[model samples]
Target chain A: MLDAFSRAVVSADASTAPIGDLSALKAFVASGNRRLDAVNAIASNASCMVSDAIAGMICENQGLIQAGGNCYPNRRMAACLRDGEIVLRYVSYALLAGDASVLDDRCLNGLKETYAALGVPATSTVRAVQIMKAQAAAHIQDDPSEARAGARLRKMGSPVVNDRCASLVAEASSYFDRVISALG
Target chain B: MKSVVTTVIAAADAAGRFPSTSDLESVQGSLQRAAARMEAAEKLSGNLDNVAKEAYDACIAKYPYLNNAGEANSSETFKTKCMRDVKHYLRLISYSLVVGGTGPLDEWGIAGQREVYRALNLPTGPYVAALSFARNRGCAPRDMSAQALTEYNALVDYVINSLS
Candidate 1:
């Protein structure tokens, strides 16, 4: 049950270690990373875990943005867009590492929607959003017009806009707030 | 302003708890939930950015008789700029969390939370637990529902008073 804060206290406790092993945390962090990677290996599929973790952090911030009123539109959009990138990048890394279960379908959709809002080019960016959209769109669009596959292609190939981005931001905010209030 | 102050005070009075990775995970989970809800709120019949936006917009749009105003700007250039940045930093935390990664997400959580305190003209001390609580709940004192928020609000008051 040694939480991060308690570990800090335990390390700082003069009675226990004489000199605090501040560097111990670095090792602990490395271990945590390994554990995370191991967990991914066991899961086999990229679990939405990382995305879920980061998603919560984003929601907390969005509530504050809404509170600040609409003064910094450019920064606001930029901030949301940037966050979207971070989440997308993290998901990409997890996926590349062979953890497909790290993100759920809806969240995967979120990544796609967010990247689309940024007007990101499909083949250029290393972002998972770009890769997924490009590959998926090409696969879907190749199907015949009257076929059900084409309809599915149309659903997946649609452009995502800033409005959707805003909606995501708002959703993350509410979800985070409620979870926090309930977790205690 | 009153609700904010009240919440801050209530938070300040709560017994502090050392944070753990689980706490961080819990914090992260809660925030993600909040983000999802925020998106849903945006899609709802009414356009509200959580409870505050609902209140702010309602007070602004339908209430034609009311005047919505911002904080007064200082006459001194340096002071004004500093104040603005401080508030921006606070707002940035909220926005960054909501939108995604903030530029300063690299800062450790406690330090990052402390940055908010500094911006708010509060002193930094051994209030990691308190700060965590505040962040987990957000800065809106009125929006708080649980006992943690009450205690967190008290802690905020104590910190603010201790500094002043």
Candidate 2:
């Protein structure tokens, strides 16, 4: 699922490589912009893999905040999904914009809000957003090749899935596990 | 929770006191624990967590930058250029090694070499200074600047030339 989104992100960006003369390259890039636009649309739809993954994990945990077999909001498990959706949307937009530099201020701000709302630690979450932004900035000087950009998007997704976003998922699941076991 | 958080922050700060290896080793234990707790609790709120998370997120988000050998290649080129300058500068001052005739080469006689080495030494002092400052100030050495490298280069010249 994540792999598909990764491919979509990479394929969406126009290549910065010089294929012929300067004019030809620009023309190629201009023409490719439409393709990139299409890719962004595809990316928005495809990135649901992240949310789905988190949701499934929560379900597997017996619904941490379950009320009648469904996880209730405000519970740790539900909070994780909420946070995941927030981050996923932000990340998807950033990727769709085809510019990672735009992520720091906007994305980080949203992350801070989510953490505050979920009663989770905002420290790592904020740092994760900042790190994500810095990562994007570092790539500003890079050539906009689909392969290169896609590789970066994919790499960036790990922190979302494993560290920041996924970390929340795992944490919620663990708490649910503990509560369920303790209750049993 | 606050106590654990405080300890972790202090440990992270203190870890900056030693050399890179020790600093990292010292912090890793506390940091890992703190990180785990934050992950487990899903309730982290502190400046330290903020900064660490920022760095972590930045690292994760920018993972692609690290994968690109091209950036590394460019940085290496920059490093090579700087080193080349150092070598050239070093050779220019090797004349001092020959000037060693009586009581430590004086400023009046071998002043040019002395000055060159002194210029070089200025940079060297900071690398040493930066490490010391990082220890005292409690931070990472890489947080120091390239100016430190340049300073170290100068200090090497000063020590070499002064050795007679």
Candidate 3:
């Protein structure tokens, strides 16, 4: 599953703007003009959950936040969390666009930089993504409306969009792995 | 060759206290060139020798911290230790490229290098050998030669550059 996503991500064009480019990403998301209130809310909630989890990690393991002695002080931690939020927003937008290409090299590089700054390992990020997927699944299970809405959004595009979303989520892990590997 | 040696020396000097990414890049570039030259020398002369060791020795000499004087125990020089690690990483880059074909160097930290080597489908022997070589002074009489250090310089450059 991850291998396929890795191939897609690596093969994707590298020209797209970074996920940190909030203004541009906002404009892109807004241009779709499609009311994905439920879907958007789910993504937002998942992102918030991950952010909170990271905060918990920070509080519990302050000493561990040192990448080769480059500690993530409070200010740096805050900035990293902010970047993580932006990454989630970008992920949501990419999911909506049904194009994994939306998460380009710039976006991945931004993610790598943020992770490095936070001194967070790839395994931790993978766990966070898992939490996100679990939360999203639970949310959909509890509210059939969100599932319906997601399906409607998928119907607007080819089934490939759905595949893209799955691939995007899978790619998230692989991307972090690559970043961590490169950091070494 | 002399120009690259000068560039590396200058970069090391400029990176007095802290070596940023750019500083490391410059140093790595020179090391790669030196490694390439050493590899070429080995291939042409058909003699197994520490061709790149001269460049490595020069780099160590310029950076006093890299001198193996039991200073690895001092916490005050962690940054210096890191610089030494980077040098080892450069050498590992050359070794992996020429002999291992695809393993990460020790500069990525031991865990990082281990993970990468595991992922690369390489036997544990080469990774262990490289780690041992990086830490110790004498060369092992293994199938691989110090010349591999010179051979893989270009490969390291490609790998590092492609990361970003």
TM per candidate: 0.22, 0.23, 0.29
lDDT of 2 at A30: 38
Where does candidate 3 stray beyond 4 Å?
A1-38, A43-47, A59-62, A65-72, A110-120, A143-184, B1-164
Best by TM-score: 3
lDDT of 2 by residue, B91-117 (tens): 222211111111112322234754664
Better model by lDDT: candidate 1 vs candidate 3: 3
Task: Give the Cα error of residue B163 in candidate 1, in Å.
Answer: 11
TM-score-better candidate, 1 vs 3: 3
> lDDT, candidate 3, residue A153?
36
Identify the leading candidate in terms of lDDT. 3
User: How much is the lDDT of residue B83 in candidate 3?
Assistant: 41
lDDT of 3: 0.39
Tens digits of per-residue lDDT, candidate 1, B32-69, equal 34333232212221211242233333323443332323
- Per-residue lDDT for B53-120 in model 3, tens only? 33334444544453345533225464344344444544434333322233233223343654654574
Q: What is the lDDT of residue A107 in candidate 1?
A: 35
- Superior by TM-score: candidate 1 or candidate 2: 2
